[model samples]
Target chain A: METYFSAELTDFKTLYNVLKAITFKEYATLRPMEEGLKVTIEEMKCVETSAYIPVQMFESYYVRPQEDVKFKLSLKILTETLFIYGDDGNLSLKMTYKGPGFPLCLIIKHNDENITVDCQIYTMDVDESTDFLCLADECTLNKVVVNANQFLDILTDLDNTSDDLDLFLSPNPPYFRISTTSTMGESQTDISKNSEMVLLFQCENEFQAKYSFNYIKQILKVMNFANKVSISTGETGLLGLQLLINEDAKQMYVEYYITSMFEDDR
Target chain B: MRFRALLVDNAAMKDLLSTVNSLSKLSKDCVMRIVSRKVYFIIPDEDTGPRKPLAWCELPVNFYFKEFNLDGVSQEYNEIYLCFATAMLAKSLSTVKQNAKSLKIKLTNKQTPCLTLEIELASNEGLQNRQLVHDIPVEIIARKNWNDFAEPQFNDFHVSIEMPHLKPIKNIVERMKNMSHSLIVSANNFGRLSLQIKTNMVNLSAHFTNLGIQSFAVGQDNESTVGDGSANESIVTATIDIKKFLMFLTGMQLNHCRTTCSIVHGKMVKLASEQVGALSLQCFFTELSN
Candidate 1:
C-alpha cells in the first residue's frame, strides 16, 4: 500500500513537545490513504521520557481544514509561542523547539486532543515517508506528516550531541569507555529536552556493545506509559529494548536497535 | 572552638594595637595579647609561676585575635585577627617613634590594678619590670602612602616594656605591609565576593556602599584612563550572600569608599601565598583630615 502524509514543522514540534515527555521516542509510519501521520509512543518507563505535555480541555473556538489548501507544504515558524490544542480548543503554551532550526512536524494525539511543535530543521530536500500502518481498536494514535526536507535540515545541522552523563559506568570485559564530554558551542544555546545527542562506546562482539545513550533516551521517551524496562543484549553490541506499549497488555513488546554508524572510532 | 578569621592591616603597629583596644570598648570577652617575639621563645616554667601573668610578650612576636560569630559556621582560623591587628599596630607605631624615646599610649581602659605587657613577655615569673607612662591623646594623622609607618613605643593602655636585641623593625613592618592584601576581603550582605584578577592587573570596584564617592567612577561605560586597554573589559558576575556584613553596613551608615587592589608584579612575588590570586578591598571612609 502506497500512502502519503503531510503536515507542518510547527505541528510536529507541538506534538513532540507534548508527547516527548510521555514517551522515550515517538514512532510514526505512513499508511496509504490514512488521514495523516500515525504516531505510536511505547509506554513503560515514564522516567525515560524528557518531554511530557499533559492532556486537557479548553474554551471555545474551532479549526476548519481548507479544502484548497496546498498538500506537501512545509514552513518554519520562528515565533516564541508554541500553539497546542486540547479537547476543547487551541491555546498557546510555554514551550520552544530548539535544535539547529525552528520548524518541526511530528504530531501525536490522545483522546480528542492533538499536539505538534516547530523545530527549525535543516536538510536538503529528501523523502522519508513509508507506507507502514498499524490497526488497533482500543489504542489512540496521533501524528503529523510534514515536509521531509524540514526534518532532514534539522538532522544535518546537528554536527554534535547535546547531552551528558554525570559519570560513566566502569568498563567490564567487552565495554570500553570513550570520551565522556559535554557541549561548548559558540552561540549561547537554549538547552532543550528535545535536543539530539549521540552516545559513543567501544565493545567486543555484536552482543557486547553497550546500548547508546541516544537509544536509551529514545525508548525511555516514547514508552513512558510503563514503569520498568527490561533490557537484553546480543551479538556485536546490539542492545534490545523490550518495552510494554500498552497498559493492560504485559505480553506485548516493541523492540529496536542502535545501528553502527562506523563514524565513531570506539 | 571554631573562630572567625579577622585580618586587620594598617601601616603602624601602634595603630593596629589601638584598633584592638577599640574593639575592647565594644566587647570585653575578646582580647588581644602578644604570644611570641622574633627568635625569642618564652617557655612555661615547671613552677606554676609565683604569680599568673596575663599577657605574653617579648620582642619579635605580635598578634592579637578574637572570635567572630555569625549564624554558626565557626572556622577557627589561625593567626586570623591577630595578624591584622599586629600589622596595623606595627605600621602605626613605626610612623611616629623613629629614634625611640619611651612613648606612652593607652590601649585599653582596664582596671589593671594588674597585668603588665613586660611581665607577660619577659620572665615566666615575678612582677617583671615597670615603666610609668602617661596617656597622650594621639591626634589622628592622615597617611599619604600605604607603606608609611612608625616605631613601637610603650603606650599607657596597660602595657609592659623591655629592651632587647631585635631585627630591623623596618624590614618586619615592610613585610607586614605587603602581606596586608590577604587580610581585607570584599564581600557583601549575602555572600563572599568572588573575582579572578589577572597577573599585575588592578581590579577596581565601586559597590553600593561607596555610592557616595562620586569622584571615583566605577561600572561606567566609558574607558578608564588609568590603564591602557579597550574600555570593554569582560566582566563575570556571580551571586553571593553576605547577610552579616550587610547588617553591619546598614547599622553603621557608612559610605564605603572605592578600592583598587592589584599585585605588585615584580621578581619577588610569593607564588605559594594564599593572597596571590584575586585580592579585594572594601574601603570605608575614615575621618577626613589630610
Candidate 2:
C-alpha cells in the first residue's frame, strides 16, 4: 500500500504534553491536512476539545495529494509511546500512516544515548457521530479574554462539591460572576471589566447559563499551560474556551466547547 | 545430622549478607542444602502445579565462614537439607553484619526445629561487648523429595550477549508494562537487543545496537553453538512475562565485569555473571505461555 502521510520532526514532547490535557477520554480522532494535524477528543458528547498542530512543527511533512486521511486511536497508548524514551533526552520522531486499515508508525530516535524505538499503533475508522460544536446564529454572545492563571485561580477557589455552576456575563459592574451552592453553603466570585487581568471584553448581549462544574474542571490542565484564555458564551448557553499557549515564543492553541445543563429546557 | 558455621571476616560477612539480601527479594521460603564442599539455596516450585525449580544458587561454605562443620544423615547420603524463611535469615544477617565481632549459626532443637544465630557485637568504647541470640525455626526435608531441588544445568544458547545498562531498560520496560502485560525480548548475533510490546491497538519496540557477544569461560562443557554464517545472522526471540523479567532486573544486582544473558530460542533465558567479586551468580527465567 502507498504511504498516505509521513512526517519527520524533533521535540515531540510538546505534542505529547498537549495531547495529555485531553486524555480524560480513551480514543481520539486524528485528521492530517495540508495545513497541519488536528486531534479531537470529547467527553460523553457534552464537552468537546480539539488541538491543532501546524505544519511548521515538523522538519519535513508529506501527504498524498488530495487524500483526506483521518483515523481513531487510543490517546493514552499513543502518549505513552511518545514518552517511552523518557523526558530527559532530546528525542526526534518520525511519524507515518498509510491509507485506511493501517497502523500509525512512529520512529523515535534518542541520539544522545544511541537508542531507537519503533512503534506501530493500529488505527480504527473514525466514528462520524460527533457533532462539532459552534456558536449558533440566534444566540446572544458574551466574550471575555483574561489571563489564564488568574481565571484558573478563580476556578480553583470554587467549591468542588457544587455540581451546577451559574455563569453571569454582561457589561455590568461585575462583568463576570460565578456562583454555586452546595451542602456547606453558597459561594460567589466576581471579576470586573476594570480589572487589570481582563485583556479583552466584548458584549453582544447579556448571557447567563448553568454548567456542570465537573466538565469545566476536567480541562484545567490545558488552561494551566496557557498564557491567555478566551471564554465566550452563547445565548442558548454554549461555553467556548480557547487557550493560547506560548512556549519559547511559539504560539499554540487549544479549544474547548461545553453545552450548558438546563433541567427543564432539556 | 548437625550443621553449624561461624563468620568473622568483615568482607565475607558483607558478601554473604548481600547474597542473602538478593535471595530475600527472590522468594520467601528457601532450602539450605548443606554438603561438605558448598551450600546451595534452592527455591522449590511454588505450588503443586509443576516440578520446575524456580531458582538455585551456590555458596561455597569455607569461603564465607571462618569455621564450617556439617554432619550428614549417613555415610552414603552425606548432605542435609533444611527449609527456613529467607526473610528471617536476611533480617538476622543485616542486623548483625555491621559492628559484630563474630556471627555464629547453629542448628538447635528449641521446642521445634530451630536454627540459632548468636551474634557477638564488638564494643567501640571501653564498655563490654554485647551478645544477641535469635532462634529461627526450620523444617528438615526428608530424602524422599531430594530430587525436587536439583541444580539447573547450563545448555546451548541460540544467542548470548552482554546486557546493556539496566537503568534505561528498566525505565522502558516500566512504561511498556502500562501498555501490555507481556513483551518480546529478542537478540541477534549482529550485536542488537530489542524489546517489544504488542496489543490490539499498538506494537511498540526499542532496539539497541553495538552490543558485545558473551562466551562462557572454559571448563564447563560450554562449546561454541554458532555453526555457520546463516546461523549467526538469525535472531532468537523469547516471549516472557514482563513482571517477572522486571523483577529479575531490579533485584539481581551482582558486581561483575559484565552481566551476560543467554537465550535458548523460545524456551528459556539464563542471566549469569562469571565472577561476582569472589562469588558466582546465575539464575533462569522460564518462558511464559502465549
Candidate 3:
C-alpha cells in the first residue's frame, strides 16, 4: 500500500538523510517515477493520515505523463528548508511544523549554493495516510540492530561524534542474530568435496531487513514524545518505520515502543 | 489518689514533669530546663470555673530550630515548633552508585512527647511549589476554598417533654436522621416514636400505648423535697439538655449523653419527660406542617 502527501523539500532532507543511512541497496527508475530535482512530499507520522504530492515538485521538473495523480504515502519529514532548480534556476521550499513541543523550522544549505527561499510551512500531526511518500536519495550498506547499551559500545568504537554525523540511533535491540560464514576447502582438485557458505539466523524471516542504530537515533534525536521506534522491512528490501505507541500512561512522560520486523525470505 | 487530685489542677504540667523524671539523669531534658513559657487566655469568662480578674503574665520561653540539608537546598526544618532544645541525635547514611544527595526528615523531640506542627516552604518555578506547604490549621484552611463552597444542610428536630412515667424522648429521631437519613422506630414508657429522614426531608410521629401521653393524668404524689421546689408540680421540673435529648432519642446509649441533669423523678419516665423532648416533638409536627 502507498500514500502521497505534499510537503516542502527542506523538511524531508533530514528525514531523507535518516532513511538513506539505513538502506543497503536501492534503484530509482526514471521511467516509472518522475525525474525531478525539486519535489514536495508529506509523510505519515502516525497510522491515520491524508497524503498528497506537492504540485510544485510534480508539475514542472518531473517529466511525467500523468497529472492530478496521487500515490501511497510512506513517511513525512519536517525540516527547515530545501532548495532546487526551477525554470529560473535555484528555487527554495521552506518546511515548518506547529506544535506545543515541536521544533521550529531551520534553514539548511544543500550545497555551497548561495540560494535561500522564504516560505511558510505547517506540519500536520502524524497519522496514517495512503497518498504520501517519504524517500531518501542515497542508500545504506550494512545494518545491525544492537541494544542501546551495546550500540553505545559500537559508537564508542566509531568515536565519530561530529556535528555532521548523518547517523540515526534508537533504543530498540533486535531479538535475533544472523551471520554468514564460508568454509575453506583443503584441496582444490577435489570437485566432489565442494565448499559451501552457510548463513545462520537467530530468528528466521521470509524477507531480509535490518537497520542501523545511527539512522534510527538521528530521526528521533530531538523527539521527546515517543520512547521506542519500530523498524520493519518490506519485500522491496527498504526499511519500514513504525513507532510503538506506549499504552502505559502512568508515566509522567510520553514513551514509544519501536519494533523492527525482520524480513522472511525463506 | 493525692497525685490525681493535684493532676486535677495542672494535668499537662504534671505529665511534663513525669516524663522528665522518667528519662536518665545523664541525658539533658530540654523541656524541664525551659525557664520561660507563655500562657494566654484568649477568652476570659467567670462561667468557665474561676475568675482570673487579670490578664495572664508573660513568661520566658526558649525554642530551637534544626535544619537538615542535602544540597544546602531543600532544607528540612525539624523540631522548630518545640519550646525546648531537645537533645536527640538522628543520623542517616546511604551509598549511591554515583554521588548524589537527598534530604532526610527526622524528629528531634524524642523525649518531649509533644506533637509538632511542621511546615515545608519551597520556591516555586512551577505550580507544585507555588504555595507554601504547612501543617498549621489556619494555613490549611486558607488553602481551601471554604467561602465559595456550599455547606451541607442538616435535618434536625428539637423536642421537649415533662412526664413522670415516660423516659425523656430526646430528638433522637432528628439525631438518628442526622446520623443516618432514614426512618426509625423507637419504643419507651410514654409512646412509640417513628422517625424517617430523607435527604432534606424529615418525618416523625409518637403514638402513645395507653390513651396517649396528654390524656394520662400526671400529678405530684408529694414525691420528694428535691423536686423543682414547686408545690403543685408532680414530675421534677428539671431543664432538659437538648444535646442529651438528641443523644437518647437517636438510640444512642444514654450513658453517652455529654450533658448532665439532676434526677427529680423516676428513671421509668419516657424520653417525652424532658424539655428538649417536648420541643423536638413540636418541631417535628411544625416541620411536617410546613
Number of the top TM-score candidate = 2
Native contacts present in each candidate (fraction): 0.00, 0.84, 0.00
Write one digit per residue (lDDT tens) for candidate 3, span A1-266: 12122224422433333333322222110011243222222222222111112233322232224533222111221111221211222233433323322332323332223322222222223233433343221113222222233323333433233221222222223322232212331111110111121121122343333333334344343232223322333334455333222223311111122223344476
User: lDDT of each prediction vs. the true structure?
Assistant: 0.25, 0.80, 0.25
Expressed as tens digits, the lDDT of each residue in B150-225 for candidate 3 is 1112222111222222222232223333323233222222332222222221122222232132322244353323
lDDT of 3: 0.25
For candidate 1, write residues B132-159 as lDDT tens digits. Answer: 3322121221222211221122211110
Q: Superposing every Cα of model 3 onto the true structure, what RMSD results?
A: 30.4
Per-residue CA lDDT of model 2 for B106-210, tens digit only, reads 988989989899988888778689898999999998998887787877567767888887667777887899999887888876788889999888999999888
Tens-digit lDDT track of model 1 for A1-266: 11122332212333433343333333321111222222233333211212211121111111223321111111111111122221223333222122212223222222222222222222122223421122221111111121223322332333236342111112343122222234654222221212232122332332223234444445443444433333333332333433333323212234443432223565
TM-score ranking from best candidate downward: 2, 1, 3
Computed on C-alpha atoms, the DockQ of candidate 3 is 0.00
Off by over 4 Å in 1: A1-83, A86-206, A227-236, A247-256, A260-266, B1-290
Q: What lDDT does model 1 reach? A: 0.25
Error of model 2, residue B289, in angstroms: 2.8
- Estimate how well candidate 1 is docked, as a DockQ score: 0.00
C-alpha TM-scores of all predictions = 0.19, 0.85, 0.17
Model 1 lDDT at residue A105: 29
Candidate 2 — which residues are off by over 4 angstroms? A131-140, B8-18, B45-48, B61-63, B72-78, B90-102, B115-135, B215-232, B254-257
